[model samples]
Target: MIDYRKATVPVWTLATGDVRVPALAGDGPMTAERLAELRSVLAALADEPIATLEVHPLPEKLDSGRGIPLDAASPLAQHLSQLITQSARSSSTAAKATAAGEGLYRMVVPAKVAAQLGQGIVRPMAAKGAAGGIRGAFVNSTTGRIAAGATFVPAGQAAAAGAVGGAGATAGVAVGGSAALTVAAPLVLMAIAVGMSAHADSKRQQAIEHITELLEQLHEQKLEDEHSELDGCRDAIDKATAILLDQGKLGVSLGLDSAVHAINTALGAADRRLARWQSALDKLPDGEAVEIGTLTKSFPGVDDHGGTFRTHLELAALAIALKRRVNVLQAVEHAQSDPGNLFESFVRALKRDQQRLDELESSIAGVLERLSALELARPNGLRPVFTTGEVDRLMSAAHRIRKLGDGVSANSRTTDLAIEIARDKDGSVVVFPALPASA
Candidate 1:
């Protein structure tokens, strides 16, 4: 079993001049295979004297290589030195052979001396030689690659000038010229390219950062808005609740139990609406884009905001039923107190009205139960059931019940007054047999 927690990797920096490339960090100890992979990457670069800036053993906890400076003694430094040296030798020889003008002369340089010059600076000189002309090339002892482009005079010319001093002096001048070109011309071009690349990379990173910040800000603003909306909704619900409570208290004061119950039913309906609102808001994602259509299409629409809305409507219908029932109860109470023929006729009408009210209540209850079940399966908002015509019909029924109750009350009052008048008139009449008991 690999203990992933215990394993650690080091970060390495590959730098060329002032522009530092991104550092690489990965797991596990350094190996020859990994070093070869890094070499392959470096080899692809056309320029030379490319320095592996430094390699550092990163702290175990920090994954990011940012801000952590490279260390000199790391394994990456050794691997880079080896690769650069090998590259410089190969490139330098190629540069010299290719630039060997009209005629070629066998040029020999001691391997030990070449190696002593170091890899870092030499590799670039060899590359320069290859870029400039086929000639004996200069090499950096630090990084063993041909200079980016060498400025050496032709090897054929240098061979001819051997008479002027010696072979050594002529070769030295040629090498010096190559080194100058490597340092001066090619280095400048490489610097410019690196700078442009770095600038472009920096801009890309900035754009990404800006986008991330904007998204975060939008999310926070949305949350604040939702909270404010929820508070406002709660206040509306509380106000409606207070109105229902006040109505109930008024009914109680007037000894109207039926009215009180109707008001209470209305309050319950309001409570259900409040719950539906809460659930709707809860089911929504925190952001602005709440995909309501997508939600409805999935899962047969049984367990969504739609069902909650239907539940609210069902509760409201219950209040309407209670209101109808209250009207019928008031009419029955009035009819029982009457005694005249007109009152009896009104009572019969009221009985028929009470039956109609009962049917309406039962119908409303059935609708509510169906709606509740639908909502439980998939909560949805209620479709409006009462159009203007439906509302007018309900009102008309209520009006008829009220008119019958009023007629019964009026007839009962008239009958009582007539009976009282008759008794008074009879008493006022003269009596011939007064005092018969005394005789």
Candidate 2:
């Protein structure tokens, strides 16, 4: 069994010249055959003629890879095409085609589920038609081939590079047929650039971009990391597509096993730090005074300032944050799944983790701010040094919790396959498409 906790697979884009690198996903290990299936889907991506910035179905190979059926007539395709057309008509064209990055990504499939499906099912599940909101837009489409995205470069950089030169020139010519058009050209270009930048920086795209970068770096430091050869890199050009698309069982659980391991490791560190911190506090004066002949002397103690109390509070907060992550994971694990609503369960799991991380992040930020506000007393001074190495470790622990928690949440959102949640009159949860949205 390939340890999913340590398994790394290749994901890349034509924009990166098809230079595939091992991307990390920590759900659990998979059979060697499953790994091969994932590779096949990635291999199919090289056939894309343009940079694909949205989720797309893995194309079935035809005629020895020289031909691919568009499948545009599929209901999934029609729905996606409509959404894309609407988005384009309502948004700026310049920002629509920017390259964020693209590559292979794993879906959150439980081992038992995989075992039941056996081999050859992976491609179908990955290629299965599904739909939901993506990057703040509605989408209904088939996905699971490869996680791909492309967003614009920074507007300023794009403008400087004259990336949209052709379109800009055409617009400029249509506006003024006179020589003064030259003078107005720069203003027109600048305006277009600003508009592109504004739309490209929308929260939807930013969130997606953030998730993409996180996945990119997830396995970068692993010793077994590998990348495709330069000769294998495919040519790419800017192509503006839809902002919304779907991936498979996408959520915090997508990297559940890896995240659990990370949280456990950090939890252990937090415990050790707390114990050491308490030990250091004990060595400090506890209001006792030493008598020297006719004089009474007492060393500076924790009672002299509020920093020690705050440090302790911060440690407790760190512990709480780590525990909260574990709790969320448990909640996901316990969520009922019996094949009927298994997919919906995954969506709910992602949403639950996302919501909890929001609150946990606020708590973590408060702890970090409090830690930063304290001024450590001189080590050689009489003041009790509550700032021990453990305090530093506590701060680091808090950061790790925040980073991992936030990344998991973002990953869930970015790769989420579908999000269909509603409440019936009785407050019973209802998932859409599979059931009526008003149910």
Tell me the whole-model lDDT of each prediction, alpha carbons only.
0.26, 0.26
Model 2, 312-337: lDDT tens digits are 33333333333332432332233222
Which segments of model 1 are wrong by more than 4 Å? 1-307, 340-439
Cα lDDT tens digits, model 1, 47-109, are 322211111111123212111111222221222222223323434432332231111111111
Off by over 4 Å in 2: 1-79, 85-264, 267-347, 354-360, 378-439
TM-score of 1: 0.17
lDDT of 1: 0.26
Clashes of each: 44, 11
